[model samples]
Target chain A: MTFVLGIDGGGTSCRAALATADGAILGRAKAGAANIRSDLTGARTNIVEAARQAFLAAGEDPDLIPQTPAVLGLAGANVGTYKQQLEAILPFSRSSVETDAEIALEGAVGSGDGAMAILGTGTAYMVRKNGKSRPIGGWGFQVGDQGSGARIGRDLLEQTLLAYDGVREPSPLTAEMMGVFRNNPQDVVEFTTNAKPGDFGGFAPKVFDYAAKGDAVATWIVDKAVADVEASLGVLGLEAGDPLCLLGGLAPLYAPRLSERHRALLKTPLDDALGGAVRMAVRMFAAPVEAAR
Target chain B: MTFVLGIDGGGTSCRAALATADGAILGRAKAGAANIRSDLTGARTNIVEAARQAFLAAGEDPDLIPQTPAVLGLAGANVGTYKQQLEAILPFSRSSVETDAEIALEGAVGSGDGAMAILGTGTAYMVRKNGKSRPIGGWGFQVGDQGSGARIGRDLLEQTLLAYDGVREPSPLTAEMMGVFRNNPQDVVEFTTNAKPGDFGGFAPKVFDYAAKGDAVATWIVDKAVADVEASLGVLGLEAGDPLCLLGGLAPLYAPRLSERHRALLKTPLDDALGGAVRMAVRMFAAPVEAAR
Candidate 1:
């Protein structure tokens, strides 16, 4: 009669699911973003709220929450203190916290060896081989996240300013971006002075959209971003026969542009990170005989 | 017997000079940094303090401050509001605030038609011709500041991270920078997360130093930075026989590295920004006979 809860927490949103030990999902719920770096208190609150909503959808009494075991995959969990802090506040009788990348890898390969890359507002890659997993990139938008949407948006902004100064040739994409800032370099300066990664990431789709129309600057940015991704994928040592799944919002947009070698290796993930979290819980709470298998 | 005050306010420090109508310096004093964009209140206080100390050193009464006409060349004075706000709080009988680049150009060219480039922690160029001055760069460190020491430092940090990620070959300069960050990419990430242009600029000398010793990455960074400076200079339209002076902390460091064409046009400045401020005050307060010259 025991159930397990799974959570996928990210900078943009948090999702939760409830499932039986056998891995049949009974209910699912979602809440606002839960980025531990910027909003630890908010993330903690959203994480609890998402779990509660999932339990309610499953027709479970609120008092039964602490009796259920849970596993969570959260953005910013690589920072050990954040994971420890989030774990301390969980209401479940037993809970474990891991990085969103870890859960995505689990969900993509289903306990098998493979590689997965997430390309959302942020970018990260994980390669699972045998029983060990190695992560590359995703050091956050400031220092890493090389091929991330945020990086592309930031590059576009920089290029627009360069065009304004006549350092680089201005194209339609640069012109359109300048118009957004009222064609004032000072306004662009002020905008970047206080901008966060997600704020910059907000401009990525426009870049991609423009690139599709063959705007030179936009095309250059997209090409560089894709090259960075390909370089990282190469660094991950993705083999010809290895299964590779692209995850996150930008994945579909970028898929067609990947090189043929990568295209042949690409596979759809078996499940999402929430399902991966649930799978983790299933492994943790399964009977000894089942866990051994 | 009336005198003038000239104030030079920069991101690193503030300096003020007391000078006669004939431009003979009676006294000079310096105080802490004064950046209006980041700390307007601090800048205001430093500006006043520098002026007061200059008067005190010149054996003049502090009460004479309000009676003294002054011209202030300050960083971040390009924005009209900053000038307006600083003007409202000035103790001088008549005070005008202009960008540091403007005053530097005045000091360098001495009422003549010419151009001057300030290559300090930031980069900006000003050209004065036929009693009109136009500024070309100096769009702050975030979007512009292309040939700047801050940009070079930021680029070095980025390359160091790339080396850490194995995306780029590790060079001695990268190794030394990584050592400074405890050889941890995460530590470097933390360092850059909140770093300001000045914080980054602090590393520029080390880059130059290493480049002098032929470190590959350091040499590449300096070459690119110098090239950018050359490009900006080209855009500024430096004709032969035009007097050009390079100003700022890094100016001397970069002067010899500039192409021979630029070196031939480079001339020693008549004075510094402080002297230019005094000249401005003289222009505003000089007797008709002296003003005519």
Candidate 2:
């Protein structure tokens, strides 16, 4: 009857799964953003609330959250003091914090040797070999995060400005983007003044859609993004036929555009990162608790 | 003699010169940044402080500030409410505010038809014809500022990251930049998190210096910047042999690199923007206030 919890937290929302100690799925729940680095207190509150909601969804007592062991896969936990800070404040009987990418690697390939690149609003690459995680470029939107949705969208805006200034030939894509800002470069400038990475990422789907329709500017942007991803994969030492997963929102779009060698390495993930967190919780705390008997 | 004041206010500091009813310079003084858009209150305080200091430097009473007619050329005044806000409360008998570029145009080519390009931490363009000032692309670092020092320095960082990731071939320029951040991409990433445009602008000199020594990467970056500046000038409808002045801190570096068409238009500024402001003050307010009437 022992219970465990797995949590996947991102910049927008958090998801939690209630499971048996042996990793049987019970129920799932979702809550608000749990971006630890930006809003630790808010993340803590939402994580606990998600766990409570998960228990209730499983037709169990919300009170059981205190007894359940947990493994949390969270955005922003990998790079800063947020990991230690989160670990110390978690409500579970026993808990551990791992990067959203680390758990993604576990779910995408396995607990063994493999690699995964999560390309959503931002990008992060993780390689797990001999059970050690080697991370590359998740440096947020201000710098790093090449091939990310935000980066692609930002490139679109920069190109749009160039086209507006007649420095570059305008395409339908730039024309459409300018239209979104009411055909005013000043409006575009004002929008970027306070734009988060996610705000910029909102334009990424348009870039991809336009590229599919053979728009020249869109094609150019996508071509560069694909090359950047390929280079990052190459730099991460991803070999031919090594298990790799293109994870996150942009995964499906980027997966096909990658080179044949990289395409050959792509494998369907067994489960999403939430499942991986539950599996980890089962292995780390549940098994130890069981072994004591 | 009725005293007048000319003030040049920028993001870094404010400079003021005291003069007689005419445009002759007396003594000059400086204070902290008077960037009104970012810091309205601070700019107001510093503007008055610089004016007071100018009076003191000219061996006049600091209280003479209230009697002095003033014209200020200020950064961040053109695109926002800062100009109007500044005028409503300036501690002078009469005051007027204009764009730093406008005053620079006045200084470089006088009150006649002319154009000026300012290349510094950020870039701005002003074309004064038919007694009206036309400004283009002073839209801050997050968006516009195409040929700016900040943009050049930021390009260097992006190229350095690409080189580090093996996406681009490495060179001595990239090597030197990475060395500055202790050869760790993470260190470079962290530095950019809080870096101001000027902080990034700090690295622009190395880019120009390396271009002189034939660094391929530096040359590529500089060439692109030159093209952008050229394109902007063309967009501004700059004609052959039109009175144009290239102003600001990076002007000397960018001067020789520009196209011959642009070079032919380049003329040495008659005086700095501060002098332009003083000349304006003498014209606008000093003539009316003068006892010679």
Candidate 3:
């Protein structure tokens, strides 16, 4: 009964799962953001707590559990610099820490040879061919990340402000945004200041909701976002018939907004990133030669 | 002695001048924004006071000034509605109230048939043909004030916030904006809230400043702004030899940034909008037959 663990660590929260070599999920755990390089002590405590909770839920004694191979997909771990810090407290004998994007790509294609896009609080695109990976877009929220939810939200917010200032004409979308901010100018300031990139990205759904209700601005925003994302795909040299997988909270919401040309490239994965992580863990022991690379 | 008063009212201050039939200045006054519709009553009073001071400076009694024919070119008084409001307060027996754009256009071209563009806190374009007028742009601050100072300011502010949210990498421009905000997050709220559209527009010069100092982001912003403004010229169906005049505070700063295509259409005007107002006023009385139309 060989066991393996898979973890997906993000900016907002973390998810961990225990599975078998054959891909059966035995248990799962969830925790808050646990990036140690960003803040070591806090991340260590969060991981320990989440693991304990998962062990209790799985009806296993934490001390009696045997150490095994694990693969942790983490946001903000794109560079190799954070590996040493992660190795200090994480409990796997053979552990691999890679960007969350890599896990998403593997999960989407099962065995690479395709592309996966993550569109959460932020956005990134990853491609894998023959076990080697390449990234196209995912420069974060600053210079680019045009199609991400955060970008959409920021655009909407700016449009709303422009309307308020009478620099632009009022739009139906402005009314909806005002409603969301409770018609208080100060609340707008508060909302923007405290809003994480993903928090703004979360507003992507609201745009769709308004578009459905006949908001021209909302529709324009969604259309522009779709175009931007599609352009990213084109930049990656994605063929017309190539398979592409979408991941992240906003992916499902944005799926319908893609143009017909882009729609043809869509492929829903049978296994998600967590499943890919577990598979990677199992491969560590079963196929050591392949794992070593 | 016959007297003609020309006034130029803007957001920050107002200027009024008493000029003779020839192009000689007799006296001048400074006031503030009197576009009561925009909610700056105090500013309007300042303008009136400035005009009074101008009359005093001209060695004329303010109370006896009612006989002088005056023409005032004010900000925010576009065509249709606000023109009526301006007609009531100005002393000209047959005064025409128009956006500062018209005055700037007149100032740039004198009495010649030509086109002038105003790119201050807002933006507008006007053409004069046979002493009659046609306007091509200046749709307010919202949908299409492209290349205006306000748009540049808004873009910089948006980019700054995006950088702070960690959605994008830090750029030198972002660092400059951060320094402007004093590293205090709340400054974003204050600067944006307290800022007028023109104030943001005023920041457009700073972008030029940074670009001159070799900042890529600032240079990019300037390039994009010039492109946008130049494209707007096409809306008027201007020809290669058309007399195009550039006005407004940013016009001088952005002159070098204009594309050669737009530059080829350029014709330097002899006077500004205030001078145009004086020209219009003088023409109104000088040619009674045309004034009736």
Pairs with steric clashes in candidate 1? none
The residue-by-residue lDDT of candidate 2 on A69-104, one tens digit each, is: 899999767665889998899888988999888778
Compared with the true structure, all predictions reach lDDT values of 0.86, 0.86, 0.70
TM-score of each: 0.88, 0.80, 0.55
Give the alpha carbon lDDT tens digit for every residue of B143-214 in model 3. Answer: 346778888887777566555654345578879788988874446645765566777876788888988887
Cα lDDT tens digits, model 2, B1-293, are 37889999988899999998877788899999998888888999999999888888888898878877888998757665778888998888888998787778888888778788889988878887678877777777876788798989888988898787676899999999889988878788888888999998998988999999999899988998888788778777777667888888999999998888888888899888888998888878866656566
Measured against the true chain A, the candidates' chain A TM-scores are: 0.88, 0.88, 0.82
Per-residue lDDT for A58-105 in model 1, tens only? 888657788988889987787649888878887888889988888878
Report the CAPRI category for model 2: acceptable
Q: What is the C-alpha RMSD of each candidate to the true structure, in Å?
A: 3.4, 4.7, 9.9
For residues B121-164, could you state the per-residue lDDT of candidate 1 as single tens digits? 88988887777888877777766888798888888887888777
lDDT for predicted candidate 1 compared with the true structure: 0.86
Q: In model 1, which regions exceed 4 Å deviation?
A: A11-14, A30-49, A61-67, A81-94, A283-288, A291-293, B10-14, B30-52, B61-67, B81-94, B283-288, B291-293
Give the 10-residue window scoring lowest on summed lDDT in candidate 1 chain A.
A284-293
Which parts of model 3 are misplaced by more than 4 Å? A64-66, A161-170, A175-195, A210-215, A288-293, B1-223, B227-252, B255-293
Best by DockQ: 1
